[model samples]
Each structure stands twice: as structure tokens, then as C-alpha cells.
Target chain A: MSKKVVVIYSGGMDSFTVLHKAMQQGLTPYALTFDYGQRHIKEIEVAREVCEELGVHHKVIDISAINQLIGGSSLTDSSIDVAQGHYQQESMKSTVVPNRNMILLSLAIGYAVSLGAEQVYYGAHSGDHEIYPDCRPIFVEKMNDVAAVANYEKVEIFSPYLNNNKSGILKDGLAMGLDYSKTWTCYNGREKACGKCGSCVERLEAFAANGLKDPIAYEDT
Target chain B: MSKKVVVIYSGGMDSFTVLHKAMQQGLTPYALTFDYGQRHIKEIEVAREVCEELGVHHKVIDISAINQLIGGSSLTDSSIDVAQGHYQQESMKSTVVPNRNMILLSLAIGYAVSLGAEQVYYGAHSGDHEIYPDCRPIFVEKMNDVAAVANYEKVEIFSPYLNNNKSGILKDGLAMGLDYSKTWTCYNGREKACGKCGSCVERLEAFAANGLKDPIAYEDT
Candidate 1:
């Protein structure tokens, strides 16, 4: 039996790799993007484009009301600076969005149940564990239990990229022969990838570790 | 020191009772409501008024985007029938709202943590457990684990009415001298409470079992 999976496609390299790997593994990928009142609307724009490019059924859900209701996140607040530098090095307080993964995954789970999809996929990586507690395995387990009891729909939450590093994801994308050029990773709202931003730094480092040149253009290399 | 607690206040009979009880128990009741794109905006109106009546700091967050993203609940959907009947006799399908309490509680946990409030109060009685899986102790236990692991905070998710029947809530509310006249419970968008709605039926039954009359007008009875 063929299984349909919904990947929380964020137009980032990590999610891009997950989507590509899903297709290679003979699974039909239904991509979901969130317009969660992020300062970087460019991410949404990029996510929409990638879904179209990949010819996958995609959904963009609005959860900005959550930001309006629950503020103080650097990602959601204009006054707060998006933390730059290594993800592990950045203080938890600087980048933490407070239950962001929990909310996003919950929305994904709801959509998956509606679509009758077998699984919900997210691109939570190992490197984010120190800062974002919701990105950890424990959160995934606890929320899966909550999702199960709440929906009562025998559903499973998948975080395939949770234990993986940037190099591993980059390698997986390369192994799947994915065109990673279409992906965007910069958190800043700039034309070119600001190499200074943590996202760009991770992407560049991953590609470099894999001995491949990243196709995305950088502004401050 | 007055212990701070966040009450999931909907200005409805049960939530209002819970908020009043929380305050009566010597805790500072912080009223929190969600504008989740429900058809009956009147409930929100009642919620605001009830908060004012209690003289507590009230906040209504716009989770409308989340609702719009989800879209298939009887409470939120105009297309669906607000199934009216006895709570225990209703079809299980009628009870499920796709992880609502879990989602709401999770959001509350986030907000509570931000405010440094360690307790979150929601009113879910035994009569509700007949249809709502979220009203069960199992879900609450799992959610507590999620809150702990996600935020590393000692946030407690409390459903004071969990083991209590409707009659029990009525008793508690009456003991606390809750202003039932100010509380709204009808799902129908009408001036008087629509006794046909499951909520109204439960309310009526609770008051009847408690040997008291519900202090609200009903269109049906």
C-alpha cells in the first residue's frame, strides 16, 4: 500500500533534503508551509516556489494570530534581533521561540489527520537540541502521546532529521541527487544569503563538509 | 505571596466557574481566552464581560489563524450542525475537535511560562469525558510531561472538574457563589440559551441534578 506523508517544508536546506529523500524512498510527499507571522516572509515565498518546483501538493497555513497572542520571540518580534552565529553557540534565550516546534508539529498533525496522511514529518536537527527544547526527542514523544489522545486517531509523528547533523542532511540530499539550489536558508530579508547569519553559516559549512559548492549566492562571504 | 494561575476563560458557565473558583482559592486568576474563529462570537462577548465582572486582568488571543488553518469543527464551522443532545449519548464523532484541548493547553503552557505562572486551569467535568478524550486524565498527564520537557518549568495543568460530574461542578460553583446568570453556555447564536445544544443540555442536567434552576433563559425549554 502506498503511504502519503506530509513534510513541514520550510524552504530550508534541512527540509529540502527531507522532501527529496521522501520522494527517493517511493513516498509521495505532501508539503506544508506555515506563514506564522515570521519577520522573514521570504521563507514563505521560497517555500511556495519549492513546492511548485517539486510538483508536490502543498499547503500554507496561517498561525500568525499565535504570534499576536504570544509575543517575545526574536523570530516573531521586530524589536528582537534574530540571533546570528552557530546554533549551538547562540544562547537559548536569544533564539528560543517558546513551544514553536510544538505548535508547528501540532498544526502539521492536524493537517495530516485531515488529509488522511500516514505520518507528519519535521526537520528538527540534533544541533538545535541545546537551545530549542521542543526540537528534542522527548518533546516529539510527549506531543505524539498528546496528539494520539487528543485526536484519538492512531497517528504517528516523525522527526527523521532530529538526530541528524547538517553534514548528514547535505549528504542525503546529494545521495538523492537533489537540486538544492532552489532552497533558501537565510533568516534575513535580503536578496542574497547573508553568510553571516547562522542559517547561511550552517548551509555553507554543510556543503563544505560534503566537499560540494552550495549553489545559493551569498552576500557577505 | 498570591500564587498566580492562568485560567482558560471562555466566559462560559464552566470556565467562569473555574476562574471564580481559582480566585476564591486565593490564587490570582489571570483570564485567558482564544478568538479561534468560532461562529458564536457571543461566547467571546460573555467571556469579556465575565472577566470584567470578576475584576481580573483578561486577555483574548487571536488563535483565529489556527482555526482557519484547521477548519472542520462544529464550534468553528457554520456548515456543521451544532449537535444537540445528552453528552453521554452523542456520537463519538460529535465530540472530537482534533486536538483542541491539547493545543489550547499547550498554548496556555507557553503563555504561563512567559508570565512565570506555574498553574494552568481549565474546566473539564466527568460528563465531558463521555465524548471528549481530552477531558480524560491520561491526556492531562501526557500534557504535563510535554510542559515539563518542553520548557523545563514546573507548570501544572489542572482540570479541577476532571473527576467531578456536571452536578459536582454546579455544587462547586454554587459553593463559590459563581454568577451563573452572567455565564453563557449555548452553542447557537441566539439571545437566549439554546437548550438544544449539548452544552445547554449538560448545563440543564447539572443544575437539575443539583436541585437548582440554571440562571439563564433557554430558547428550547
Candidate 2:
């Protein structure tokens, strides 16, 4: 029997790629998304689309009340502006939601545990480390230990590309036949993705590194 | 200056008693409630009402989406009824919620860390030990070690009545003007609490021990 896995699917390039990889590894994927009152509900919509397209078991858990308690990220609040700059800058005030990955990954583990899934996959790559500390491998390792003791089991939080950059993720996704065009990667919830946002910038850069323009169109360069 | 304490307000009798004790200690209470989508929405409402009456800061963190992921308790699920009669029965199927106390306390600690709070007050009495392993002093001790490393600074989880029973909690509440009338302690949500339920049973017994009948109404004696 195939092992069960739940991917933290955002319908973004990284998560879509991660889901594809899980399928290739012969693990049954349970796609889990969070509606944490983020500014971009588009990613959630895209996530639903991708999950429907993949025909995998999908669950969207609502933890929006978490935002009521923990705030400060651009993704969560209107006060913060989405920065249209490079990814690795400290000036990117648009970055950093408090314990976002921690909270989401915790929920994902909960879902996985509920479904009796042994593994939880995330798309936390080197690209994310420039913005989110929780994306770093050390955090993942530490949280895995936390989950193990919290659940009193051997549940593993597997971030297969924590050491890899976005280019690596794109290549992996391409190999897994992930349709990056179907994915949404913008932090700005505009008519079309504002391609200059850090996420958009990274996505465009990754596709360019693969010697191809990003298939998705954006309102801004 | 009054000390700031994080009170794990579950809207239950023990938690209400804990809140009253925090006030008596000259600490301003910041109430933390977990909205874990239990069949017990009444208690969450009671939590809100109590906190409002106390004029304290209240934060309801929704962990309902991750139910049974950490704890396996009858309180969280409708499939199991709240146990009645003996609390020490080995076959008390109504007494589990995976890791109820651990997760709630961890979230409280997380909130306390953000608030720069030194102490977290919870209601873990000897009366609850017949059912909840997480309510035991030994687990709280071990978890204190875990929290010390899991967080940047240590936050103490204080169970004021570690050796006391439910009647002790009621006695404290009565002394502290807890406004027991507004607080709801019944597990069964109906016109009136089902007195036979574990929670109502306990509450009545506690009030009875104090030579006072419970102010709250029950469908039957």
C-alpha cells in the first residue's frame, strides 16, 4: 500500500510542484490549504482548481481567527504594502507574518494526523529563507521534533527542497509535469499578478533560469 | 503595577475559577480560548461573556480545524458523549482529546511569549486527573522543559490548585465574585444543562460541596 502524505498546497508554483513530486514518489497526496484571511484569496481559488484538476483529496481549513491574534504580515493586513523588489532585502517590510509557516505547518500536521498520514510535505525552499525564517531547514527540523513529541508519534515534516532554490523547484516541477501556468504566485491580489512582487519576481526568475519566459501573464512587469 | 497573566479560559468551571484566582493575585488576565469546533460552542460563548464582564483582553484562537490532530477527547467530538458517574473508570471513553491540555497550554504560551507575559494560569485540578493525563502536574513539568526550548524565553504554566478538587475551585470562585450565573459549565448544550453529564455533574457536586446549590440551571437534578 502506498504511504499517505498531505501537502501544504497553496496552488502557488512551489506547492504545486511539491504536490506533483509527492505523486511521482507514489505517495497519495492529501492537499491541504489554509484560509487564514490572507489578502490573496486568489491563491486559495487556484489551489482549489489545482486540487480539482489533480483529483486528490483536498481540505481547506479555516484559521482566520489566528490572524485576529497574530498580525503584522502584508499577506494578512491591509496596512502593509506588498513590496515590488528583490526577495532577499531586509527592507522588505511586506515580508514576515508571525509564525505563519509554524501555524500553517502545525495545522497541516494536524490534518495529516487526522487522516493518519505519516508524512507532511512543504515547499519551503532557499528562496523563501530570504523572507521567512520558518522556511529555513532548522525551523523545519525543530518543528518536526516538536510535532513528534506533541503527537507522540513519528510524524515527519518533510521539506524536500529546503536547501534548494526556486530554480530547483521549477525544474523538479517541470520534470513532474506540473503545469506552472495553472499556478498563481503573486502576493498582490490584483486583476493579474503584479509580477514584480517578491514571489512574482522569484517565480519569473525561476522560469527564466529554465531558459523560458513565465507562461503566466501579469498586469505589471 | 499589576502582573499580566495569560489565563487559559476554556469557559468551563475550573477555568473560570482560575480566572478569578488570577484577579485575586492582582494580575490582569488576558483570556485565551481555543475554538476547536467542539460540540461545546456554548462554553466558548461563556468564555466570551466572562471575559467581557471582566473587561480583560480576550483572544480566541481557532484550532478547530486541527481537531483530533493533537488530542483525542470526547469533548472535541460528538461521536462520544461527555462521561458521567465515575471519573476513575478505566473505560471512560468520554475522557480523551488527544493532547488537549498540552496544545491549549502551548498556544497560551505562544501568546504569552508574544505578550511578554511571565505566567500562564490554567485549571488543572486533581478532580480532572481521573480523565485527563495532560491535566497532571507531571506532564506540565515536562512540558515546561519543552516550552523552555521551544520558545525564546521560559513562560511558567501555573496550576493554582494542583492538589485541589473541583469543590476547591468553586470555593475560590465564590470567594472571588466570579459571577457564576453568566458562566456556562454544561457539556450538553440544550435549554438547560444535562446534569448527568460529566461537566454538569462535576459543577453540581462542587457547588454542593460548598453547601451551595449550583446557580446554573439543569434540565433535571
Candidate 3:
């Protein structure tokens, strides 16, 4: 294989676009998914299917241990209910997983360096900057500096969507002929997407703004 | 319970000293151990025992998935032979787990924020700076900055022994009257300490330089 890059492919809409974009750029991308014991673990299944279709090597790392260690977040804690609404609403902040991108990026850096990959790709869009501190521009910039000195190879983080919102990411996927139905965005782990959840709301609004209906089935679509 | 500090306890002499020292400072320390598929996994059992003795909460997190992800290091990869010599020797660099401290510190920060702890304690001594990049002062300083931006509570990393060497750590352990026999440091995991590996050599030399015999049984002590 040519020089490769590690992608934090979470089997979500944003990450699906990232994996396809990496391939279109002629980079050998390895998909890295995490089983962090989130309510929506079904995303791992979607991630595996996408990797199989793309014919890329995928590593589904069990980071459930970290989730078990830090139990306050609503996404991982059973006691806290996942709030549902438009993502920009303040109540949607309950779905924020603390330091999630940092933990994922750290592991991706280690994996990329170990495999001699030059870069790590994670899909942290401008949409997440409002609630998740780890997804903000400052955190990404600081983490890049930390990763530079953390390893001998100094594998860097490449988040192309840091300035792009959900609609921009959806447009990229539509251009790449991605079957977005295979991607998941529901915080509620059910057979059909809970259209009211913050994640589903953002994803639906993005598709609508892109002049396309979301491919996935929604409870009230 | 008052404010607590999370300790990255590895059931090794240096971390054993950190646990005791944190207690002496009147900080309730919660021990966090990661079973990252190290050759000496028995050390985790030792960690549990020590935490029980200290009457503190112990969290043994299974992060072996990370070891499986990054496979080059000898400590986690069984295919690689652990080199035997003084730790300062160039050959000992094979044992350096890339970004090991950063990964651990990241998890500790998450756990600290979850528990609302003010600080995270790790036992990184001066002796490791020559071989491990992650154990260097620069890496620690950068990671602390990253942690500050990564979380809401901003739990800081407190590495008290960053300037202390093996003998200096051993002296602190002795002052605390810790039973060093419970700790394990041999890189080559076995019923008896492999007295020739880099880890064993540094540990034995530390005890000797401190004018005390190591309490653990060795192959040729």
C-alpha cells in the first residue's frame, strides 16, 4: 500500500464523508471506529459495513473502558436521558460527550504513528463547536501541537470539516455517491431514527438545506 | 469525601510512591490502572492489592484494545524481545511505548473531570526521560495544556516526581514504609524477577543505591 492515513470513522454521516474524501484524494485510509459503549452502538455495525464496501482495513477499538471510567456523560450514562431538540438549542448540550474527540484523536495518533501513517483524519465539523469543547478550533490546534511532540514520527491530525457545517459535509457525500442510508445519526438507539434527537435534527436539516431528503428512515419523516 | 485526585497507579515502585505521597498530602487519591496487554499484566493484580491496603477506590480499566491498536512496542507486543541492560543504554529504547503517558494522562483527565477531581497524579520520574519521549517534561507540559482546554473542569496533571530519579523515588518509598515486595518491575514477566532486563536492572540498582535490598524475589538476587 502507498502512504496511509488513519480516519476516525464513527459510522456517522460526517465520518462517512471523511472516509470517502480521503479515498478520492488517493490516500490509503484505514477506518478506525470506537465501541465506546454509547447508546448508539449500532453505529459500529454501520461503520463496519461502510469499510467493507470501501475495501479499506477497519479497526473497531474497544474504548468502552474509557466510557466506563468517565460515566457522567448522557451518551454513555444510562441514568441521564439523551435530550432531544434542534442541535443549536441549549438543551441539546446534554448529548455532549466530554473530551471525546481528544481521547479518540490521541488513540488515532498512536495508531497512525505505529503504522507509519503521516496523518489522522477525524470528522469534527463547525456544528459540534457549540457544545463539545474538544471539537472547538482551539482544542484541535492545541492537540495537533501535543501530537507533534508526543511521538517519534509526529503523526498530525487533519480535520478538514473543522470549518464546514453539516450541510457542507452532506454535499461532499452526495458528490461522492455515498449511500447515506447506511450512516446513522440518531442518539436514540432504535431501529428507526428518532427525528427529534439533536443528532437526527442536524442531519435532517443538513440534507434539507442541500435540496435532498435524508436517505435514512425517520420515525416522523 | 473532600476533593479527590486521580492517581495513575501501575503497581510499580514509582507509582506506589506516588500513591503514598498523595495520601500524605491529605488528598484522597483514586487509583486508575489500565490493563493494556503489557508483558507484566500481573502488576494489575498488585495494584488492586495495594489499593485495598491503602483503603482507596481502585478502578482497573481494560484498555488492552489500545495495545492491540498500536502494535510496535515490545512492552505490549509479545513478538518483540525485551532488551536486557541499564535503562540509559540505546537498546532500551525498544521498550518505549509511543505516547503511553499522553494516552494515560488523557484518560486520567476524563476520569478526573467525571469525578470532579482537581488534579491527576502520575509517577513519571527523571530516569525515563532519556528513553521515552512521552515521559519527558515537554510532553507533560504540553499534555497539561491540552487537558486544560479539553474539559470543562480542566483537571491538571500533577507529576511530582518528574525531577526525581529511581534512587530518589526509592528513598521516598522507604520513608513511607511501603512494602516494595508487592510491586513488580521485571520486563520479562515470570514467577521470579528476571534480574537482567532493563526494568529489573533499574529497579535493583535503585534499591541498592538507596542502601537497601529489594524486597521482591529475583532470579539471581
Highest lDDT model number: 3
- What ranking emerges by DockQ with the best candidate at the front? 3, 1, 2
lDDT of each: 0.80, 0.76, 0.86
The better-scoring model by lDDT among 1 and 3 is: 3
List model 3 lDDT by residue over B1-221, tens digit each: 56699999998889999998999899999899988888877788889988898799999988888986788778888899989899899888788776787788888888888788989999998998888888878888888888888866687888899999989998987888878998988877788988999989999889989888898998865
Q: Per-residue error at B93 for model 1, in Å? A: 2.5
Candidate 3 scores an fnat of 0.72
Chain B TM-score for candidate 2: 0.92
Evaluate every candidate with DockQ and list the scores. Answer: 0.64, 0.25, 0.73
Best by DockQ: 3
Error (Å) of candidate 2 at residue B31 is 1.1
How should the candidates be ordered by TM-score, best one leading?
A: 3, 1, 2
Per-candidate clashes come to 0, 8, 0
> Which ten-residue region of model 3 chain B has the weakest summed lDDT?
B93-102
TM-score of chain B of each: 0.94, 0.92, 0.96
Over the stretch A1-221, how does candidate 3's per-residue lDDT look in tens digits? Answer: 67799999988999999998899899999899998888767888998988898799999988887876777777888889888888778877677676777788888888888888989998989988878888888888889888988877787899989999999998887888878988988988899998988888899899999998887887855
